[model samples]
Target: MSDTITWGMMLRKLPSIANAIPRLVKGMKVANVKDPTQTCGLGWSFEQATLRNPDGPALLQGEVVLTYSQVNQWANRMAHHLIAQGIGKGDVVAVFIENRPELLVTILAVAKVGAISALLNTAQTRDTLAHSLNLVAPAAIVVGEELVPTFSAVRERVAIEATRTWFIADQNTCKPPGIAPDGFINLMTACADGCADNPASSRQVFFDDPCFYLYTSGTTGLPKAGVFKHGRWMRSYVSFGMIALDMRPEDVIYCTLPLYHATGLCVCWGSAISGACGFAIRRKFSASQFWSDVRHYRATTIGYVGELCRYLVDQPPGAHDSQHGVKKMIGNGLRPGAWGEFKRRFGVNHICELYAASDGNIGFSNILNFDNTVGFSLMSWELAAYDHDSGAPTRDATGFMRKVAKGEEGLLLAKIDDKAPLDGYTDPQKTETVVLHDVFKKGDRYFNTGDLLRNIGFGHARFVDRLGDTYRWKGENVSTTEVENTLLKHPTISEAVAYGVEIENTNGRAGMAAITPAESLATLDFSELLAFARQQLPAYAVPLFLRVKVKMETTGTFKYQKTRLKDEAFDPGKTGDDPIYAWLPGTDTYVRVTEQLLAQIQGGKYRY
Candidate 1:
């Protein structure tokens, strides 16, 4: 990608630049939070939004439309109910609900009570789900009726009392009373009797308090609870909403991403709230109907992931692709290859791509409407030389890390200081695992982002790849351990190692596993293994390709030689004695991947 800023691109961005100046000027004033302990938090922000436009459209889902007053009043009632239940500041409340109006209201209510909302991933089940719930030790849990069955399967594994289990009916509850199954309290009915006035706790809550515990995939294969504070929320409220997007009251943001994730909850929804604009949502994303929903909501901006863009671009051309009203977009993981196709085909003007981790201290915004870059960070950041073989940073003769030259891929690190603190994770040890000390000078500290980036000109950088064992696929980070753990449960598999390999036209890596059969390769049932894998793991986490080998190669430390496996990939020619197999998209069984089939798959014949 060219690092130079062309005059034609500048001229094309003239109108957007003109409109963004006022928003950026106004946003920078409130974006500064020198003293987080002294500033108000989420409750204050939401209340201010309600006060801004009481009757303006706040949320739209399906045929339902809620005003700012309606949502605030609903959340206020729930907040009062929470206080009655002995829940208050610093308490953790596990919110086990899918993407819906109830999920947002539950979190907002928890915010008003000054409690941390532990947003549970809906795709998780069995052991993974139990680990996340027990990690936080929530004071209470609010479950949507849709997820009650899934939660009930593992309720016995948690420590919460039956009475403390709150449930919101799946059906719309216009009436005061709603139905709930046994061992579940109807949260809506109980809260309906409470006062609908905003609580005094809103002002009492400060920026340092925890607002949400969003999960990120851990190297150990389990999810880690990343602490997201109100102070960071202030950054998102300003950076994406006020500075980058600059949305108006009439603008509606159509977000189809999951609410439990940072990009959807904090960035997209927070930006909508910052402008007091309409926030439209759906339970799940469907590429086929994406344009129809955008048109129906009249969304001016849309939330997207890299894979989402690829899916849309993969669809057959249609008039709605370029006929929609969407003019702007805000999200991350949009690949450079599909960026132009998505923008040109959809008629979007500005792609306000953002870069930030739920647990890290650094953030970047595309404020100047730049292409193929994360833009720039407001705080101190460094791109240091990395040792790819050992997966560590390189040290110079002085025993200090060296900075990678401009236009080179290097590991990204952020300074940890009072100005920009690393919020870290629920587990202190896990948080400490990411910290690097004495990088440049003695006693100096930095947070390792575990990401490689190439520094372009103009203080901007382009994202390169994620380091270590974990790789992202289907917009979700796939842990090698997680996939390997699930693979071990198969009777025929004695050993397994998982890694991601790049496909020809795909945005991110595709999951592949090298396995050793317990008996002979002919004795193993590929169909049975595929069935077992699909049952044990999420669809995205399941390995797409399988390589059968008699002996698994390892390093001197007994670690699987994943680098070799990744380089060999699923190509049968590369694996001399070992045979390779592939589970094609929409297929139930694995088939032998020969040279001819590999060429056909890579030549755009298959839609994987």
Candidate 2:
């Protein structure tokens, strides 16, 4: 091989470097102009986009194509309608809807009137749904017509008044049913006659005002609502939209992730608004139809989570796999092993791996398109040595947290101050649990991310693992305590311990539970238990593997011991006499984990 490069090769690289300069300049301008005092909210961004490109396409949902001005007007109409019902600044409006155009529109409408939109996760049921709705104490709630039955089932438990409960029609029916359910008014009919003028109240919303609340599973059985301030959304718009992805006005973004998540709501949608781009959305992700949808919409950019990427990668190879127009992707949790293969197979030009929590103050992005890294961080952050067993920061002799050396894994923490303050959760007491004081210096504070990461050099880091009682699965965070509480609710389940176990070829860990039955194993109605789990928790949180334990192990304090159970995992070979049952996909009941089934799992036959 020649040591020196040819002149032609050097000349070819010049155009590549030249093409990035304009984007660099635009990104710099966006960063410099991101002012907290400049009324930087989603509503402000919506107005600016409408003014800049009123005729440009904004939203694409199946047969519908809404322009910027049309979407703005729709939001305005909804805002006026909501204001007529006494919803205004400082008020909270609950939104319980699936991923639809109205979901984002309702959020914007709530923001336009200086009201906080509490985005309820659609996966919740009954008591969990009621807890989330009651947590915010909303002045009103907007429910999708398809979800009306679920909302109606828990209406009595929720505190929203009958007059304030509004129902938006689903895709199947643009109008509410002729006979509306009691205590629910049809929002479409009510807002059809409302004014389309922009509400003046949006001007009162400042940078620090709460804009949205996203649910995150807590240490308890219920989900804790995380505050998402307008200021933070503005930052993401500048950093992720303008800088990292460097989107343009003509770009069309395809987002299949749920809108309730920050990755979809703040990063994906904010990027579209910042660059006046178009968005093609889906109600939910489908691996089989992902590329087809991308091609149908002519999407130049796509959003994903690790699980979605794995699902797409697991599908059998076909001509359509590489036939889509996706040039760039922006998301978190793209596993290191799958990174190169995903890009190579899908022909993605850029992969901007990002890392940030809904309530955390700091974040990282792959601005330089680095491989196997979460890229650079602009804010002050550190990798402090942590206790893996206890899931706590390791203190040095001087009573200060020690930073891990480069390339070593440690706990990720963000310095908290006036500029990088943790927005925290709706429960202030729960907020206090995640904040650590005197971390490195006297009287200093840091926001604990509860995640482990490697301190890769050059300001970049690699995500290692999640700590404490929380584990991520299927792109959603699962709390061990929450699942355990639900499992114990069954009369036949006397003891239950929940933990996550690594599957051979999965994006995140799969949940598993070790339980001691109250009676003979044959007497236990596993199908009924599965039904109970499906009712009490989201599908992702339900344990996939169940170990029938002879007796439950406990610590000196009587706390359930998950260490030994986690070590043994779900492997029947290592579990000794204890039998393991697995909830196979598409199956109604639990089946014994036979050697053949274990081999199938190890060989990656099941696309779990």
Candidate 3:
């Protein structure tokens, strides 16, 4: 029989066979690995792989290929130097560096010493940078020489002692003299005499021990440090790397995202668990050079964010566009519309779209080759209705947790108990705010995932929008993601953000959208774009007003910041710089929004 016939027959017989073999359908395996006391989790696995594949490629930087043995030796030497500097178990070491081999070496070294690593975002300014340092209160800070000015600006406000700061000089790059503070140490000088083969000397770390702290993107407000335990990090690797991406030891993974982000740290780092080589690009993502980099590094796999993917797809197609070796790509936030196009254009076989939060305990992955869904979770979790304005769980008079029906959107929560601990932030109050206790059953607890998700089917869920991003319109909740997705379907739009704007005499907030058109489509046909959105999105969800911008402001993680955009809604008088357009229901095209129109809308004369 032909392959197609055999596949068709197998699909037809699956239902009957599934009923006969219930255990197989439910994914119950008879033989499972029994080792429970494996002290060497992911870190030790990498060490073993490095030893076995010493001559094999471990990291590829342009034309430079660093073997596994070389990386292992450098990490060992760095670990010894760190230990000599009084950094050991339970100590918090802050890392502030870009995506480079040195950054990975530093992380591994810290882990070897049983010390917790706190990776700081290099994109943060003085105030936010100081906030991150104060939250962790690190024993020592290791900063890249390139980011010295940023660190120097915030050094006084950081809680760390002056003597604990260390600056890493990139020898290949220029060195700035007098950039380092008086008491700061230099990493090159400190490790100059350290031996590479020093014996490992550290206490065994448990699964519950804090491994790292990733700060949340402060899009809503101030950034909070989210503590990641060893167990959870390991689990993340298993789910994202092993099950989702199906990564193998021979696969070379390319990461352009910042290392500080969870997707880079947990997902990309987890690729190391498979003994795979990871290629780090020590610069911001450039759409033009993306394919060339992939070809240059011979990368078989790559990780991405939604914006990065969109940017790549928007680039003008070239003869060499599909002439790369990338086979599989994994990350979260790939919009449904661009999913198929990305695969077709890039010639990628697998697009593992995942869903997770930095602080939340629950996670989902696209394992069964499902398209447009964040696939089922292997662990337990729940979803319930959440109030946006109050920022709390909504309950009935009977004191029972109200869960959204199948296919409806609701807040995602993870069951937190002895088996699944809520390894929250250092602040107890912030931790308390995330825990929902005694909701469905007596003494049961759940970790509140602030984002909302909708059940798609087959144990899978699709990301809806963040709770703060969703707003009420005409007694119906409007999902920002849905509106944004609709707006993006228009060929002219490159990016879009949907948010609620307050209006006088309005029972609920009005929908306002900001759009950035493709460069080629700069002379936008607003009438056609508006019509497309109106047909796809619900009447109430359609934007009553639109603002055009050359670009949208986003966080380091590429998430659009709505707080600032919402504050500067289409008040033509206040926001005179950017052109504003308004959509009247009956009009074929959107009219220019002027000060007179803004006043009339505020006076309740204009109806959406």
Candidate 4:
């Protein structure tokens, strides 16, 4: 889709804007970031919802359903149990659970006690798990039944003691005694005799106080724990839930994304609670079972990641594709290439693609249901000219960064102030890495988003690419995201991971792509594939090397594992069984790269 919004399109969206006025007013009242007197947090929001819709379905996972009152009371009981175990305000409790009602219940319980729930990535194990555990230094740990084995393996390496170790059964145990491992204490069982009343500590939980510690998806390296404060979650509730979806009690948001992530935990869940709506969660995403689950829940909305949408689109067109009640979607990374296809296929009215880092203050939401845009931000922000090589904002002779052209791609910078405060990573040094001091003017601070965006029109902008992900090739810059999106547009390419690779004698990095075909690589048409990339991309932007694989590896959050792919490059030894294809210089067709040909190419046999 074009970044420019035509007059006709703007006129069409005028009605949507008109309809959003009341929501905007109501949302602003709750979302007063500048108001010092205002105090909003997760527990406060949940308790308010209990008053509004006590009997309504608050959470659903398969046959297990929890009402607002039931969920609140259960969480309260667990809160008392935790307090009894000597856990108090600001203490970190590592919640190690998969997608389940109990996971959320545990988080709520911890929040009510004014303790921080360090949402550990369930995918983590061994050394990585120990690193994350030791980093947070959780005073207590909640291990899910399914994940016990994994956690048990690394338990010896961690610091927490058995007295503080908590466990939740795979099944509901809130009302009855549940079985626990020898060394583990059943959280639900312990809470059975505790008070079910709302804790006074919930009200004391301030906006600036850290509510949860969400680990960043470790795509580039070891994951960093990013602070997710109550203020941020409340902002999401008012902005995404109250304003964007205006979720009603009848609305049920089906989420298949990992609950540990902000997109699922805060954005989707917060939205549901904001309107006293139902929230349905699945253990993990299954593309084949996705639609079935949606239909089962009678979901009115969905929480998605771009990859999930792509997987659904990749599913063969069936009669039941558009046979669901889903009207809205809220999440991030729905690529422009697949946005239209997803909308057209699924028949969802609003694809509210959002843009926000767990560690960053600024957030953009597609409240107007705009196509191909991350939508708009009300926060003070700027698009600044940047140096791709250094991956930093480029400043002028006056030592001030200039704003990018209205429609050009630039590094996104969010102004850090009293209203838009940056509750960054746990490590002070890591947080400092993202803080841009004296950005536009003396004494002015900006949160370097490290993302490139195109300012389309109004307050909306289209996501371009990650700052470091864009490669300088030849004399021009090439965006890996743009290239990957272009590759995905092809009918045969099921998955595409684009990155920069260094050639032995090349002036700069060359564009390379690792793609997984729908069928075997034997049937893939090289000429057609080359033509598709050429038609959609520039000469420099087109990948010089193409690696065909049966599967594409991704992180827990569904981001491509580019670090490993870049290391393998186009070498047979490094890539193993995966076949490498290359678009050689002066060649019209892509050819297989044998060890004999690879030597010649790397020895500067031909000019690129």
Candidate 5:
């Protein structure tokens, strides 16, 4: 193979490059412009698309399609209704609905009336659900009728009056579920009498104003709400929607990811609206039905996370697996091990892997279609050497952060400025924790990403692990993500979580992996698993302890929650009946932990 750049690759990217320049120029002008009336909010952008492509399909679910004109009218009517209910600028309207066109309609309607939308996660229940709703202090909540049961369970705790609760019928028949619960108003009935015209309040919305509050995935406790500014939303529209994915007006996007998250909301659906393309949405992701849905919509692009891709790959191979029309795939967390096979099997030509946090100031994109890399960042950023044990940046004698050389792993940081403003959490104190000052110079401030990444050549970087997830074992740093990715390459292990465990006599934390095997508990080849892991990993990186779980626990965005696992830390008493195996020192294979061995291990007898 040639070690030089190919002209064919350059030719393939010319169109995206050509399309990005003008869009970026327009976005910068919008971001910097001061006039609230001139800056285009989400409502303004949608209205523009409606005018240009009135009859084009805006949203799709099965055979149901909502044209841009129809969606605009729906949003207009809902906006009018919300304004009549006394919702306006600065008021937060919480939205708790599933992935349907109405969900987008409600959020867009909230935006049209210059009110902020609080996007609530649908997976949350009871206290978690109530806490999220009350955190934003929403003036009103638009609830889907299908989700009424879950909402009703925590409705009293949310503290919002029944009069302010609006019920949207997920099914088209809309009989208001026979009896309306408490003071809830049927939004379908209300929308019938409302006007389908743009609200005057939309003009008051500005680029700098808070557009919505996206909650972080609270693995340990209640999630923190992060403010997302309209300015940043517009920038994402231009970057990911227009430049990165570079969808055409004729293209359709198949989005299975939840709309509550930024990747699905801003990147996938927002890209479709920005390019005036069709959005094919699902209520939730289904590994079995994914390809069929893609084929049904003739989708040219699909969105994903790493776990979703892994699920798709784990299913039994069939003729229909790669028979879809999808040509482009977008999103983050595509592991290097699976990236090649996924693209080849699915016939996808472009994989735009991105790196960004919901509330963080920095973003990196695989704009050049580079393999196994997060690609180059357009904004200014730095990589500082980090201490694995202390969980902080390693500093020089002068008290400044030490910069890591190229090809070395370090914590990623982005300088805070007007262009790259940190729209931190709703709590000011919580926001202060992520901002670092006087790093390179006095008075200079930067946003800490809390992620470790390798600075590969030519400005490209590969994700190593999260700050706290990378643990020290045997005087070497062990990246949990790396170990998990390696374990996932095995055919039998469907999912895995790698963390550190406190062995009685261990110098540092010992590597342990909790896994969900593909086969029955009796059929899993433990010896094969050990050999495979040993082949792929170094001695220090290979997990010493193996935990077989019936099912793995995950957060809303499909991230493994390691807090409980780390807390348990190989303690048989806390882990219950889950089987634990240990690779003893000088042993070639793992053995089941007996009662005596467990006691001995806990009593500092093992030299791990």
Candidate 6:
């Protein structure tokens, strides 16, 4: 009722008007388009950059380099073959292959035909492989010859009536399994013979159409398939590739991550958006060969995950460590402890650390050269505190959603309106679970990203930990990342994972730590790490129990999943042969957790 306009009122109005102007103009342009069908999908982008740039390198694998024109021609040939084999629009084709030229070619072929390509994680075991294939119900499956054993194991469990199954081998060979009555084809032969006689199918495709389905870790439960629409894929190309990295058509991108993951598929493929070349690595990441490969391929840019960076930093400093042609690096999950060290050792000029999930609608990139922070978003989104136990947002007294204060950790949510569609998945039930409606404003929708992040000013955010990775200790919230960072500072520790375990009569959960010691520090003085952690972390945050592992289990994407480790806890009796240690409050070092000690602790006879 005051004459003076409050700052909050003025700020709110300004943002809405600011966001609408450009969007309104874009909407009008699209509405007035003379040919609406031509203004859709990757076809538009492909047409903009024709085959005149054919001589430019588009892909590099080892010593081989395929030009942009060659890549497009190969994809077109493959697409024609697929169409002849009864695989066209609306069909789901599962591709099980490693990082190779064939993988990229297959994905492009699938997209060209307006089909949904399900890129299956090659690292998945038989059970997970079966689950993934069953969920997709692909009309056809394309696999590498090396993964024949994997498909053989899960073939009985697959329910889809696949029309064709193909394998790419060293030599063009059609060796179909006995049970596969649909017949087998060889990729080499298929590409050799172009489908010139078959006419192109006439099907309606839109920007909102599903191009690919990327599966996320089922850490909460079972893995859910996340659909990536053509429009969202195009957006990644513009935002991350063009605007963020400012990549040029001549840039050579070194991609070591698996092609099945979203980071490699979207960011790496975004190089193609500018007609840039992508160098693919097939084998597991080797620190010794990392710089050599970069130098050999003359890669100007590289993509990485946190573990990849940590592994490189853990290696002994070589004479050529600082000698590399890599000018920029992009990807997510780079921990704060290794950020500066990685850049200094590798001599990388630009570290575009981005934060996004395979299923997440919201994304953040380091556009402003912010250190240890994921940069701001150009779209609409919100962050709110989420209940870990219930996996939902917390509501206030008036049933209104609460937003997290700046610098506080919260679950990221993206506004899903008509403009920003949440083309979730084929499974509607799984999709509904991630969408929240009528939160801050009535009739508004938001996509819940189950990640905990701290807003680090200037529209930047730093990923703190996964919601499940965080634990309550001594009535205070303890982030696993905070503990992991402190442990990494310990000279003896090589890798570490910190989680919480329920203890008898405990207020909430007690801290537990797992570590893999450096080889040189095998005979490490345990007192040093214990004393260091005690000085660095609070009393409640310091781990009460410890487990030493020679190697830690990680997902294909190199993310450490603590669920199984948390379930194993610190019971020495059940730990098989791995060493377990326990810390007594006043002790300067940790002592072995013997069977008798574990029994006593579980029986409530021992207190620490």
Q: What RMSD, rounded to one decimal, does every model reach?
A: 10.9, 11.7, 4.6, 1.4, 2.5, 5.8
TM-score of 5: 0.94
Clash-forming residue pairs, model 2: none
Global lDDT of each candidate: 0.85, 0.81, 0.76, 0.90, 0.83, 0.75
lDDT minimum window of 10 residues, candidate 5:
173-182
Per-residue lDDT tens digits for candidate 6, residues 1-608, read 12223355446647544654554454334322234264444534443343446577777777777776666667777788888788878899999987777788778778778889998888886888899888988999888877878787888788654447787773222121222223456665766668522124323456677889998865555677889877777667666776677666667788788888888888766645544545456456777788888888877888889888999899898888888778888988888888888888879977889987777676778765556878677667778977765547898887868999987779888898655568787699989988888889888889887778777664667787877788887768889999999998887889999999987765678899889887743666778778888899998899988888888888877877688778889987667777888887667888898888887777777564
Best by lDDT: 4
- A best-first ranking of the candidates according to their lDDT comes to 4, 1, 5, 2, 3, 6
- Winner of 1 and 3 under TM-score: 3
Worst lDDT run of 10 residues, candidate 4, spans 31-40
Q: Write model 5 residue lDDT over 1-608, tens digit each, in one string.
A: 12223466567868766766786676556545455557567887788778878999899997789899888988888899888888888899898899988899888999988888999899888988888988889898999878889989998787786778988877772122343456688886777668988888767777788888999888767899999988778777767776677767788999999899999998888889878889999998898999989999989999889889988887788877778888888899988888988987778888889898998987787877878777767678999987778888777999899899877888999999877888898889999999999998888889999999888766778888888888898899998998998998787788899998887766889899998888867767777878888999988999999888999888756888898899977767778888888888777777788777889887877677
Q: Which of the two candidates, 1 or 3, achieves a greater lDDT against the reference?
A: 1
Residues 175-279 of candidate 4: C-alpha lDDT, one tens digit per residue:
656689989988877788889899888887877889999998887788899998888887879999999898999999999999999899889999999989999
Worst 10 residues of 6 by lDDT: 172-181
Q: Put down candidate 3 lDDT per residue, 1-608, tens digits, no spaces.
A: 01112345446646544443443232222111123444543456567667667677776666657777777777777788888778888799999988777777777778777788898988987888898888888999888877888888988887777667887775442122334546677765666557877336433655666778889888878889998876676567666665566566677788788889889878876764454565546467888888888887777888899889999999899988788889888888998889889989989877778887778777787665556777777567777977766557788877878888877788888898654568899788999988988888878888888888877655677787888888888888888888988888876778899999888887788898988887643578878877787789888898988888888889877998888888888887766567888876567788888888878877878666
Model 2 lDDT at residue 52: 84
The sequence of per-residue lDDT tens digits that candidate 2 reaches over residues 244-284 is: 88777889999988888788889999989988989899988
Give the clash count for each candidate.
0, 0, 0, 0, 0, 1
- Candidate 3 lands at a TM-score of 0.90
User: What global local distance difference test value does model 6 have?
Assistant: 0.75
For candidate 3, the 10 contiguous residues with the lowest summed lDDT are 25-34
Candidate 3 residue spans exceeding 4 A from truth = 1-38, 173-183, 198-203, 387-391, 520-522, 573-576, 584-588
Runs in model 2 lying further than 4 Å from the true structure = 1-37, 172-179, 218-220, 469-608
Which prediction has more favorable TM-score, 2 or 5? 5
